[model samples]
Target: MNAVAVIEAAVPASPREEWLNRGKNLGAERRDVDWRLADWLSEGKAAGHLDQAGFDFLADNLGIGPAKLKLIHKAAAIPTHLRDTSLTVEHHAHVAELPVQEQIELLTEAKRQHWSDDDLRKQTITRKVETGRAAMLSQEEWDDLSRMQFLHVWNRASVAAREDIAELVSQSHMRCIDA
Candidate 1:
């Protein structure tokens, strides 16, 4: 009897390291959201790119009472950085002048693991994906979750994707993740 053969490819280090290091030095959220939520939001607010209505729309989806919404609106608007899955706590730390090799480590690992943009987006939107280092969450976890739920309304995924969640199956168990 002959045994079946399989061919697998190996991933390199240079490109992955480069990607994890790239996309930095682009934010300036040190004043507002950078300290609280994200660097992009701080810059957005400071630059006058973030509008109150956009925040109002985001706040409306929060399901908080009208009174609380007013308070949030008065305090700070939703940071545009939250919109990107790649944005993480390290981004804020970078703005505040903090060292975060863990951030790099986690990102490198995620890249090596080949987590797709959707996978990273799922983690960000679900508040499950955080910077490798722990300090403070960028935004209200509920807010992120709620925003994801709201966006799902107009967004349509493939049948396979719909099953990706509802199927209650683990790819690792089927030689996906662990492989």
Candidate 2:
């Protein structure tokens, strides 16, 4: 007599777990060492032991660009407890470049949304662009830039003359204020 055997399948892993597994499959060991190096660099920087030459040497020896080393140093500024190890060093580096409060908010959102490193980088870039634009442009300057861009496009379109485009732009501004 043959008896049938019942086997239970394993539960599926969460996104974080899946990501961790993927990283484990990759060169996680090397990454761990990199993280440690970042920490060491941070400590040295804090103690004023690491100078420009030291940074340059590390960057050269590591075979990474100076910009990447700078990012690693910025990432190391994040406190150990607050750091989200689930994210890659690059993600931390991007977030660390932001203000402390913004860094926390972005990291929290990234973890909650299970964002990829690229997603985090994109969001960081967008925020930086917005911040820079706001700082560099007054409302009048921004409006001028917008109008210039609109005029450039309208000039190429035979359907709308300069006067018509100007009228439409004014109407759009009025509509925005009304809303």
Candidate 3:
């Protein structure tokens, strides 16, 4: 018997069979079109065929905003080998903004922790904040700031006094950086 005939014969004439057949048909044509479009955009950008104006025009025509196009470009830049295909596009978009090492670290952590996109986004924000705060403090200042006494003082300080102290520390750090 022919393959199509055999397959049809195997599926008994029932509602379940009809639903299964419909699902199979739909699944057969499913494609990752968004990823493909992002890759195409990245290729065009890399080749100098697509600049900000071109990207904006194309995005406008497609009904997606410039921010979405930028996200797609970022997602496309991530090497295929490094991407977690099982993750959602939003997850990939979040990790794509991170540095390569941090991306790997977070992806690994996400898998280990079974984190949702929201969880990963929160972690990313925390990481950025911690890095920024660390950048603002010298090693000695960091050590001092971590002390219990300093914490107690900061906890007890008035709002105005806290602001003045922060301003002074920021100026001192700026001077250190300039020198």
Best by lDDT: 2
Candidate 1 residues 55-161, lDDT tens each?
A: 56645775444434333332233234322234433322322211234334434544566665445434543433344332333455356556677468526777776
Candidate 3 lDDT: 0.71
Clashing pairs in 2: none
Comparison by lDDT, 1 against 3, better one: 3
lDDT tens readout by residue for model 2, 1-179:
99999999999999999998888867667556657878988889889978888888877887877777776786787878878776767778777757888888898899899998667866775676677734544454456556665667877877656667567768896665332
**What are the per-model numbers of colliding residue pairs?**
0, 0, 0
Ten residues in sequence with the least summed lDDT for candidate 1: 90-99
| Candidate 3 wrongly placed segments (more than 4 Å) | 1-31, 111-116, 132-179
Best by TM-score: 2
Clashes of 2: 0
